[model samples]
Target: MKNTIAERIFDFLKDFPPFDVLTAEQLIIIARNVKVIYLPKDKFVFKIEEEIHDHFYVVKDGAIGIFRKEDQVLVDECDEGDIFGLRAMIRKGNYILSAKAIEESIVYSISSLLLEEIIQTNTEANKFLIASFATNTRNPYANDNKGTLFANVKSLQKNESSLTEVQSAQYSKNPITCQLKTSIQQAALIMSTKHVGSIVITENQKPIGIITDKDLRLHIATGRFSIDDPVESIMSSPVITYPENISVAEAQIAMLQHKITHLCITKDGTANSVLTGILSEHDIVAIRGNNPSALIKEVKRAKTAETLQHIRKKVQQLLQGYVEQHIPISYISKVISAINEAITQRAILLSLEEMNTPPPVKFSWLALGSQGRKEQLLITDQDNALVFENPPKEQFDVTKAYFLSLSEKVTQKLNTIGFEFCPADMMASNPRWCLSLDEWKNQFHSWITKPDKDKILLSMIFFDYEMIYGDKNLVDEMSESIFGSIGSYKIFLNFMGLNALKNPPPLSFFRQFLVEHSGEHKDQFDIKARAIMPLVDAARLLILSNNLKGFNSTIARYKKLAEVEPQNKDLYESCINAFRVLLRFRTQQGLKNNTSGRFIDLKSLSKADRLKLKGCFKPIKDIQELIKVRFSLSHML
Candidate 1:
C-alpha cells in the first residue's frame, strides 16, 4: 500500500544526514514507522530525569531546544531535519536534558529499534551519529574537529601522514658542543665558525649546560666575566632536554614554558640521557616555512618596502595553502595577524628613520576594520587612524605636524607593501583621522550621542580599532572612553543593531540567493557585506553591551559570548562555525579569482558548494534575531 505521509517524511529525511546515507528501501521502511508529533511553543517533548523514550526525534519544522537541567541553559537547537533525544536513547539512560519547542514544532519520532536495525549499518550514517553524540549538534564542522565527519575520511586514512603539529621535529643531530673546561673565548670561536647561536657544554657526551649569544652579550661583553674564563662560569645550568622523537608542538610548548631558546634532544626523554642533538627556536621556524617567527624575522630584516612587499606576497601564498589544507581559520588568522603587525611595526621604524626628528609625543598606529579584527586573510584597502598622547597646548601644532609627516611616510610605505590606500582616505595620513587621544574620544562621543547614518557606519568600522604599534596605555584609554560614551547613551547600540540587520543573509522567500541587481557585481553575491558583516556587527554590539574589552575578532567575541551566556552556547557555537566557513570560503574564492573574495558568482558554485555556502546563513539570521530582541531594534526598525 502506498503511503503519501511516509513518502513526504522520506523526502525530507533524504536530504539530511544519517538518513541521507541510508538506502532508499531502508529509509522508506523507517519513515513508514515514524510517529508524527506536534508541540506548541514552550512544550517539552521530554524532561530531565524522565525515562528515555522508545524513539528519538527529528524536527520536520519549527525549532526544538535541548536545555541543561541544572540551569535550563539551551545547549542545542534542533531545526528542520535536525535530530535530538538520540544520545540518551543510545546510552539507555534517563534523559539528561529537556527537549522543548522554543517555537511551535512538528517532529518525526523514529523508534530506536529501527535505528539499530538499519541506520547503524551504514558507515557514513555511523560517522554522523558519532559526531552528533560527541558535539550534540548535527553540523560536523565543530571548532575542535576542523572539518565534516565525512570530510577527508578517505584522504586522512590513505595519507598515513601527520600534520606539522604532531610530526616529529627535525633537530640538528650534529650539535655544536664543548667540554665544561673549554674557555669562553674558545667556545665563542667555535660558535662563530659553526655559524651557530648556542654551544652545549657536555661531559661524556651528556649535556650539562649551554651558552648562547645572549650569554656572550651579558657576561663577556658586559665585562661581568672574562673571555678567558671557563665556559662553565657563564653556562646556563641543568639544560632542558627532550627525546629524539619530540613533536613540533611539544618542542614549542617546552621552549615557551621554560623560557628557553634551545632544548637538548637526548637518547631518552630526560636530562639523564646522552645528548643526541639540539632543537632551537630557529629549527622550529625553519621546519614551518610560513611560520610566524620566520615571517616576523624577515619583516624586521626588511630594509625597504619592496622587501616587505615580497614577504607579504609570500603571506598570500601561505594563506592559500592553509585554506586548501583545511587548517583551522582561527590559527591561520592569528599567524597572519602577527605577521601583519610585525610588518607594520617595521614600516613605522623605517618611517621614523626618514623623519627629521622623533615624534614630540607618544602615539599609537591603529589598524581599523578587518585588519583590526585580526580576520584579514586577503589583501584589502588600508583602513587606519592615528592616536597620540595629549601634548601641551603650545606644543600641539608642532606635535601634530611631526606625526602627520610621520603618518605620510608610514602610509606611503604600507602602500608600497601592497596595502592599497583606502579609496575613502580613511588612512592615518588624513588629518581628520590622525588625532590626539582626547580628540578621538570626543569624536567617538559625538558619534554615539548624535547617532546618524554616516556616524553609525564609521562607528562600525572604527570601533574594531586595534593598536599595531605604540603606547598600549593610549589604546586602553580610548577603549574606556568609547565604552563610557556608549554606556551614557545606551540607545546607540540599537542603531548599530539596525545597521547589522540591513544586509540580511542574501536569501529570499523561495530560498534563492539574492544577488546584487545592479553594479559591477550584477547577479553576484556580496558575501562580505551580506554574510560576514552581519556576524561582525552583531558580535561587536553584543560585546560592547556586555562592556567586554579586548575581543576584536568576530570569532573571539562569539566564543566569549558563549562563555558569558551559557544558555546560548549552542547558538554562539553555530555562529562561530558559520563564520569560519564563510571566512574560509571567501578566502578560497579570493585566492582562486585573484581578487578580493567579497563578490561571489552564484553560477560558479557547485551544488555541494552552494549547500555549504547556504549552511552558513542560518547562524547569521539567528544572531540578527537575537540582536534585534536584545537591543529592542524591531520597533525602531
Candidate 2:
C-alpha cells in the first residue's frame, strides 16, 4: 500500500542531507512512517530539557533556529532540507538544546527507530550523522562537511568567540502576564515565584503596560504606592514592543532609544498586538559574540558626538582583529561600513531631536569621497553633502536654512566621531553643497557637461556618492539624472576616462616604485595617489561608462565589472586582490604611525612586500590601457 503523501515526502527528502545517502526504496519506507508537523514562527519545535520525540525532523520549508538555552545563543540555523531533532533521539535523553521555528514551516519527522534501522547497516550514513552530531551543526546539504555541533564547546566566558549582537535575541516564550486590574500584591507574588523581574499588564492578550522591580522599588518601596493597589495604577503605560524577527542590532538600538531593560515581543510589532515573548537586555549581552559588534551596540547608546568619537576609535581595534583574522578585505569593508553608517544614523537622529522641529522637506545626507565609497579604513575627513526635495520658491530659503542647520549639527557630530572636517568645505553644512533636488540636478548637469579641471576633479570625487541617511529615493533620482546628463554629453566620459589614467602606476623607468622625489617626505611611496587611486579611477570610469547603478565601493565595482565583462574576469580578479593588499598595507601603516597610510616608507618594506606591490601595478597598467583605448585617450597620452 503505497501512500501518496509518503511518496511526495520521499521525493523531497531524497534531495537533502542524511537521507540523501539512503536508497530510494529505503527512503520511501522511512517516509511512509514520517510524521509531518506545522509550526508557526517563534514556536518551539522542541525546548530545553523537554522529552525527546521518537523522530528526528528535517525542515521541508522555512528555517528552524537551534538555540543554546544556557547562553541564549543562536547556535545554528537550520534552513530548507536541514536536519534537526536527531541527536536527542539518538542519545535518548531530554533535549539539552531548544529548536524553534524562526519562520513558519512544514517539518518532516522520520521515526528514530526506522532511521536507526535504515542507517545502522550503512557505514557511510552512520559516519555522517556521527560527524554531524559531533559538530552539533552540519549543513548536510552543503558539499563541505561543515556543521556547528561543538559551537558550545567554549567556556562560560566565551563572549569573545563570535558576535551575537547581530543574531536574533531569543526571547522568553512564556512571559508573565497579568491583568491591568490585578492587585500589585498578586503581581509581586508572581514576579517572586517566577524568578522574573518584570510583569506585563495585558488587556485581551495584548501588552498594554509593564511593571518591573525598578517600578516597584521607586514607587512602592519608596512608599509611593501600596502593594494592594492595582498593577495598572503604578505600571508604565504603552510598553515597548518588537516583532518576533528583531535582530540583535535592532534590539540593541530599540533598547538604547527607549532606555529600557526589557522589550515585549509582539506578533505585529505593536503594543496593540498579541504578546508572543519577552526579550530582556540580559539576553542581548549574554550571546554577545567575540565580534566587536559591541561597537555597533555602543554606537546605539551614544548620547553625544564625543561618545560616537570614542566608539569610532575602538572600531580600529575591530579592523585590526579582522585583518589579523585574515578576513577578506571586501567583507571587512562591509562590516566597517555598517559601523560607520550606524554611527552616522545615530548622529543624524540625535541632531533631529536637537532641532526645534523636523525639516519641512525630505532630504538625504550623502557621504562623498572615501567615506562615500566605504573604503575609508583609516579615520579620514568627512566628505558629505545634502539633497533636499525641491520646495516652492517662497519656502525654499526657510527650508534650506533648516536643513543646513541640521546638517551643521550632524557634521559637527561626525567630526567628533573622527571624520575630520573636509578641508575644502564639501560637507552638507556648506551652503554650496546643500542644495534642493533641482539644484543638485543642475550641479550634476554642469559637472557632466563642462570638463574644466576643477569641475573634473570634483566630479570624480562626487560620483562615488552613497546615501548615509534620509530619503533614498532622492539619491536614486540623482543617479538617474547624472547618467542622463552623461547620455546627452557623451564626450564627458572621455574626459573622465582621461582622469582615470592621470596617476599612472608609480613605477620608475627601471621598475623601482616611483617614490616621492622632493615632497615633504622624500623616498616615500604614495599608495593612495599611485596604487589605490588608479584602481579606484579605473573602476569608476568603466562602471560609469557602462551606466551601471549602485555599485559604489571600488571592490564592488570591480566585481560587477568582472561579472559584466567575463573576458576581463582574471584581470578584474587580480585588480581586486591588488586593491585589498594595498588597502590593508595602507591600513596597517596608518595604524602603526597613527596617520593616513597614504605615504609608505619604501626602505621599511621587505623584498616580498616589494614584490607584492610591484605585482599589483600590472593590473593597474593593464586596466588603464583598456580605459585609454575605450575612450580614445591615446592622443592625450
**Best TM-score goes to which candidate?**
1
Candidate 1 local Cα displacement, residue 207, angstroms: 13
The collision pairs in model 1 are none
Question: Taking the tens digit of each residue's C-alpha lDDT, what string does model 1 give over 1-637?
Answer: 2669998888877766567678898898998899999999889899989999999988887668777643255655566566788888878899977899887789999998888878556776666556556533333242112222233221123111224544578999999999999999999999999999999999989999999999999999989999999999999999998878776656755664586889999996567878999999999887786554567779999999999999999888667645544445776787778788888999999999988877898999999999999998888989999999999999999999899999999999999999999999999999999999999999999999999999999999999999999999999999999999999999998888888899887789999988899978999999998889888998998999999999999999999999999999889988887888788888878988999999999888754467777878999889989988888888887
How many angstroms is residue 26 displaced in model 1 relative to the true structure, after the best TM-score fit?
Answer: 17
What value does the lDDT take at residue 571 in candidate 1? 90
TM-score per prediction, in order, is 0.68, 0.59
> What tens digits encode model 2's per-residue C-alpha lDDT throughout 77-162?
66556678888877789998789987678888878888778777876567666655543334212212112222221121222322
Number of colliding residue pairs in model 1: 0
RMSD of each: 9.7, 14.5
lDDT of 1 at 355: 87
- RMSD in Å for candidate 1, one decimal? 9.7
Residue 471 displacement in candidate 1 (angstroms): 1.4
Task: Give the poorly placed runs of model 1, Cα more than 4 Å off.
Answer: 1-168, 172-278, 285-290
Evaluate residue 465 in candidate 2 and report its C-alpha lDDT on the 0 to 100 scale.
94
Q: Candidate 2, after superposition: displacement of residue 239 in Å?
A: 30
Model 2: lowest-lDDT 10 consecutive positions: 140-149
